[model samples]
Target: MARNFIRETLAKENETFLRRMEIPNKDSWSPENGPTSVRRHPFCSSLKMFLVALSFAYFSKALSGSYMKSTITQLERRFDIPSYLIGVIDGSFEIGNLLVIAFVSYFGAKLHRPKIIALGCLLMSLGTFLIALPHFIIGRYKFETSVRSSANSTNNLTLCPTSVLVGNHSSTLSSTGCENESRLSMWIYVLLGNILRGIGETPVQPLGISYIDDHALEDNAAFYIGCVQTISVIGPVFGYLLGSLCAKIYVDIGFVNMESISITPGDARWVGAWWLGYLIAGLITLISAVPFWFFPKSLPVPEGRLAKCSPERTSFIKDSPGLDHKYQADEQFSFVRLAKEFLPTLRSLLGNPVYVLYLCVTVIQFNSLIGMVTYKPKYIEQHYGQSASKANFLMGVINIPAVALGMFSGGVLMKKLKLSIMGAAKFALGTSLLGYFLSLFFFAMGCENAKVAGITVSYEGMESLSHQNSTLFVKCNAHCECSKTEWDPVCGENGLTYVSPCLAGCRMSRGSGVDTVFEQCNCVAGGNLTAYVGHCRHRESCQRVFPYFLALCVITSFIISLGGTPGYMLLIRCIRPQLKSLALGFHTLTTRTLAGIPAPIYFGAIIDTACLKWGHKKCGGKGACRIYNTTAYRIAYLGLTLGLRTASFFLCALGLVVLQRHIKRQENGTLSNGNTGHTVAELQALRKEETHNSHSDQSPRTSDYDPERETRL
Candidate 1:
């Protein structure tokens, strides 16, 4: 009787194990079968569904991030802060990423990845809403200008009145004072919000990409990543287009009377509705989280798609004896066990020479890409003489679409050519080199600096103002009692910009708002003593050069984007499959901490040195720059971008050398192993099983083959 009881216990244990391992057929799955039922749901089980959901998540994050970049200038002006200060705000996002990426990428990968991703998306949504909070909390934007009082009021009768004409022009200056009496730096809110955004965005890329790579067919992984990346770029197009639209609208559109506002969107003082886009982006991100919650942590490999792991793609280091314990049911996980493994795992990851070198290359390259992209819109406005709206529109409508197409094409080429790891590295290197060459032409395409009298040129327009002790109080405007603090610029007919109508020695003004024209200006050189209410238009040659520059930019963007997928594939394939998530996380952490955070700050600091005209804050300090020395700005901007790219190229060459040697070693090991008949027979058997499984109607599920598949590879 005791023997029979033992047999029954053994039989029951065997039955339970089989039940735990079984993958339910479609007809057997139902809503009543507990939590596993959710995983078995048709839509939730599909790789395609996950792909679509992941793509939208990528799009939502990219849209918000790019929108922040698009509004850099507007933020600078609105906050009454310098460019360097604004750069700090831009870097805050990276700071947020630095805080959580390591833990999320490593530990989170072991949990319900989709649920963790959902939580992250919710955090991102909150952060985006926070970014928009300042606009609503702060009083309406009040741009710094000399003509603060109404144009219809008698106080505006003498915009450039001399002390003799109006007792003192200082008296004519509006005394409403700064609306921000407390001198609060409202941009602090934006900084905090951006940091939160960074934290939230941390999981989306590394986790999402690694998840897709983990589940999809090996051959189709690159294409899936490509589709996600391509779709993500489309988000930027919408983001920049949204930026352009917001830039055209006044910052205080519904709150203020349109007729009272003197500045046009072209003015340096103009602050667009930069806050609106964040709200829209936040809503979209929130919606993206909902789909993820229903998705299973893992999915079955697509039907009829055999597993294909290239020999070189195998891990250089052997797996730990019982590392598989970490991937078991969530209830079985132990904090002590994970903690002990963390350092060793990290050391193993860093020990790989290829991964280390790739990090170096990517860090330097991202430094260049981030800095250039952050300021490209500002560069267009400052260098090419395009309005903020126009610059954003061009990037949205022209540049981004090319990038999307190139990313998709790169994936298609990878699949079609069946590029080996080395071939992919070579392909990426070639495209990067070609793109670097194409980018060199941008150095020659800059327009001449705006001829601001007493700033860039003397009042007589004979020569540039001396750099030392340069002052706006020239002989022509000496009689006028201009404050010298205000930056309300006006353009003279002689193709020169006056710092303000008051500084231009203008004694009268006509219409109200943006249409107001200052007449009888004493400083104007020609007989026509009239100055318009804006900066001077660029010369025809400069205008023609802009189109050519844009055309080159589009081509270069496409070429550079062609390398993205191949490079990303290299990053994943070089490491052990077990380390993919952690490697990605560490890479992101390193790039964001070393590259993303500092590039903008340092780049902005350098760019600040090129400022020709700095605006004033009523609270008393240097504010946003009104104009830049186009020559200096162009050199500083393009020089940094190209110099970094050049450094990365050298690094890339070294990495390829290391990778080639490693590949040879892997090939040699495989060849030696293949000579053994037993090993050859085992590989043949595994391949046969894979083929049969793919072709057979009654094949076992993908999970059933994982161990054997890894052994075969």
Candidate 2:
């Protein structure tokens, strides 16, 4: 009763507040008058569209990167699979993604974006469910013995120098051998699941961009795109945090100590509880799809026009004064057109030496950033001898701040320097590469010392005390030394032997020093010390690398964000009003398709190979393994850094050259591709008209078509 009364009172207060604010109730509103009258409601239709886009973005972010990391790590630990094979699995996600993107870009324009998004969401959920099923089966039976025996056999059965496990074990094992069955079956399922997810998620990228392009004005496109990308960053951050939290919870719950039915007392549990997190993520993804049913059916396409009035005046003229106009509506929204269109754009983009250079630089920068992000945690665990949870936490702690600062700085530099989109991208890429190098240096040093310090400090105090006590007695009491010969020290000593006391004291002091030095040196020499320090140092490096890496990621994102801005401005300042949407759409389709397809596979391959080599450190000869592991990681980092730097330089050069050309063309009062001055001026006039018409409720009539559109289309 009390709870109900409180709720009733709060509801009444809320109603009173709304009344005071003159908030219009949605039920009493009409759509024809627009959303202004019911300002409190905003545009439900647009809001729904935005939310749908957000959901897809979130899932894509989670599934593409963070999920890959989690799944690969799980596979490496549970199945003892080689890192190279794991790389293949990781790369497969991208392969699947690329193929799907191609197909979607061809067919998606005909399909409703909402339905496409929904389908993708469903498929992702299914994939996650299938991938996780085998674990459940294995967990249920508690089959400790069979798994242990098979693992032992596999360890004994080395097939090649690569340590690849490639036998048909299913034939030899009984149905009840759940451990082996689960291990083998789960991987197969996971691979299949990832492939399905890749295909499902493909349509999401293009469709999402289309949706944003459809609703947002051309001038604001880039800003909105940036907002989307910013949201994307959240997915990984959340995934990493959740994954780490789950791991900690598992450890705290003593899940790590539960022995397999057949293993030794200290054996780890076969089925980890951390998997629950994956299941939960899938469920959340599914739930996110619910709002798609309510998305608006269509949006008003934007039109271009020009005003005869001055900049401050609102009155407009229908056509440019004293100019023959030629313009037409060119819809490039069809899926078939997008697919067919991409090849030409891709060719053109590739042919542009500047663009090609930028692409290469971007790829390399992304590779290094991704490689470090994916493996830093594992590196910390292996090198610094830290737990997975602690390593991950340390990674988060270091990266969050570094990335935040890098992102802020990148934004500031772009704004202050008045960089064009490409210039900004180059600056971001270069800065990120520098960060990667600095992180690598710190990581290497930290790893070396962390191991040396942790172990030596732990053992040094006890050893030092032992030496001190031995030395103190030798210096203070001569009778104590005489007791060694006669048992009775005071009565049977025949007086204290002071003759050799000085020598004994000197020897003890020298011995103590030698012992301390030996212990310190010995601890440092063992590569295990590397493991402890490596974890923290690697984490710190990753954190340091985050901003630059984030900046690099956002560079492409920023380009995508600014998608409609250039074309819209070109239309308003120079192009036919009727061609605005069509031109903007064409540009958007070109850039997004080109950028999105290769990212998944390219990054996946780098991460996979790095992981494989990192895992191999566990198998090599004892003395050589740590060195091999450390060297392998160093090589990986070097590859990433060099690749990024090369890319950065290229992008910077290309952007500078292109912008210079664009500016020169503007100054000459001539159009590229040799259009006439009259035609160009008329086009610019139409764009001004379209911008004015867009802000008002007036609809554009079909009779406004001009001849220039025919030639362009």
Candidate 3:
């Protein structure tokens, strides 16, 4: 009886092991074997469905982020703050991103990622709405002016040329007398709202990309990433366009007459309808969240797809379906285990010299990108003398679309050529070098600076400038009661921008608001007396350079972005496959922490040093800059951008060399097997399986990083 019982126990134990281990269907799957049935998960998505959902989510988040980027200048004008202050506000988003990204990227894999992502989307939408909240809460905007158009009309009437003038106006200077008014400083609301927006944006990329990487077919991964990136980049096109449209709308909108606004969008003092874009972006983000909450935490493996790992090693591969058990089974999470693994995993990643170098290259590159983008619009307005509206329109219509095309083409090239990791690195390096070479030409495309009296040119309008820094007062207008801090600019017919009607020695003026024409301006040269209420537009030479600059911008953007996909793939494939989410997270965290938060601030500070004229706050102290020394501004902005890019090229070269050597070593050891040369051990098994299955009914698609699909050298 005892012998029989022991034999029965041994038989039951064998049955259990066979059930758990995916005992290979020798008849169904072997090198010489015939076609066999394969199991698929019920909850798995079709490629089409995954693309649609992923694209929409990326578009929504990018739209909101880009909108904020487009409106920085507007915010500075509206809040009466310096460029550096606005930079701090812009960097708030990076702060929020830094706080939660590491934890979320590390822990999200074990949780219900879809729900977490939905929650993040909801927060982002809420934050956007809150950013717009200040517009409604604050009182009607009360701009300071040298001409009080509301109550003093008689002085203006006396100096009027009835032929050019129509409305009753005023010339008596007025101040809002906002003495020490701390209670109504609503800029704080805007700052907090932006911070909230930053927090909300944390999960969109790290979680979303990881989710796609986890479930999408290995062959389609890079292309899908490119598609998602393309859509996200395209989102900024509409964002800049939206910024352009809203800038034309008066900041007060329905509350004030458009005709009554003394400043046009081209005016330095002008504040665009910044809040409107935020509102629209918020609504879109809200809509983006709805699809995520319903998406399953994980998808089932697709049918007839060859598992990368063997059936016997199913337990070793979390993502592979080597066994028949449902994906939902064996669900578990432990914070203790997460804590235990964190340091060891982190150490392992840092030990990889290739990843560290890639991280440095990306960080430097991002710093240049963020700083350049942050200041590009301002540079255009100050250097090219384009309006904020025109600058945004050019960015939207030209620059962003070029980036989308470049990104998509990169993906297509990778797919068509089936580039190995070494090949992709080489491609990325070549494009980066070419792009850097093209960008240096921008230094030659400089436009003549604005001909402002006492700054770029002498008040007497001499071509020879004695000093960059000059006093606002000259003999002709020195006796007039002028405030050096005031920024109520007027354009004389002689093509000089006056500080104000007061500084112009115009004791009288005609018309109201933008129509307010200062007549008999005492400071005019060549006896030209009339001046309009706006800065003199830049010289005609500037108009010709504008198109050339746009062309260069388009070409440069395309070439640089062409390398974006290949570079991203290099970052992914260098690390162990299991740490993809963590690798991505750490990279984001490191870049954002070291680069994103500081780049804008330092750029703004350097730009601030080039300020020629500054506006004043009614309460006290310096506010926004009225004018910049275009020469200094151009040199500082473009020089910094190009220098960073040049430095990145060196790093890129070194990284490529390191990667090539590493691959060569792996190849010598017979470890590297994939077309992309990923050194994972499972590649050989999968490759062996695929080679023998060529005679089967269905075959897998050829892609970049696998052995069965060798790349064309």
Output the number of the TM-score-best candidate. 1
Q: How many pairs of residues collide in each model?
A: 0, 34, 0
Comparing candidate 1 with candidate 3, which one achieves the higher lDDT?
1
What is the per-residue lDDT of model 3 for residues 1-713, given as tens digits with 9 covering 90 to 100?
A: 23554455554443333333333333334332212322433424544565677688788888888888888888888878888888888888888777777677677766887888888889889988988888887657766565545634645443312322222122212233453354666777777777877777777777787778766667777678868877887788888999889888878999886666788788887888889999999999898888887776666544333345445333323223333443224222235656777898899789888999999999999999999998888888878877788888888889889988898788789879899898888888888889888988888888766877776777777763534567678777755545567777888888898777766666577678877777777777744388888888858888888888899999989998888888888998888776787888789789989899999999899889888778877666788888887777888999889889889888887888899888777685564443555454346445654654563426444442343132100
What lDDT score is found at residue 436 in candidate 2?
Answer: 43
Q: Cα RMSD (Å) per model?
A: 9.1, 17.9, 10.0
Give the poorly placed runs of model 2, Cα more than 4 Å off: 1-64, 139-185, 216-227, 249-272, 299-346, 421-426, 429-433, 443-628, 638-710
Worst 10 residues of 2 by lDDT: 483-492
What TM-scores do the predictions have? 0.81, 0.56, 0.80
lDDT of 2 by residue, 1-713 (tens): 23554455554444432332222443332334422333443443574467556655565546435645644444554444444455555555565676566458756755677777777777777776666666555443232111222222222222111211222242234233533432243466667776777766676666776677655555666676766766665566566666665554432134333332222211222223446656776776676566665564444322211112233211111111211121111133233555676676556444544344444544444554445565566555544444556554554444543454445455555567776544554455455445444544433333322211112112222231211132222222222221111110000011111111121111111111101101111122221111110111223644465455434433433332232233123223222344344444444444334433343344434434432112221122111111113334555555654555566565655656765565465545445425455454454555554564464436656555433332233
Off by over 4 Å in 3: 1-53, 148-176, 209-227, 295-338, 463-469, 526-528, 671-713
Per residue, candidate 1 scores C-alpha lDDT tens digits across 1-713 of 23554455554443332233232332432223422433445632477888899899999999998899899999999887887888899999889988887778777877788888888899999999998998888887876554444656543576755557554434344334544365557888899999999889888887888788766666788889978977887899999998999999988889998887888887788889898888899999999999999887766433222113222211211111222333344225445656777898899899999999999999999999989989999999988777899999999999888887787788789989999999999999999999999999998897877788888888877788745645799776777777777788888888888888878888777777777777887789943488888888856778989889999999999999999889999998897777887898788778988898899998999999998778877666888888888999999999999999999989899999999998777666557656533333344555666565565447656555553233333
Ranking by TM-score: 1, 3, 2
Strongest candidate by lDDT: 1
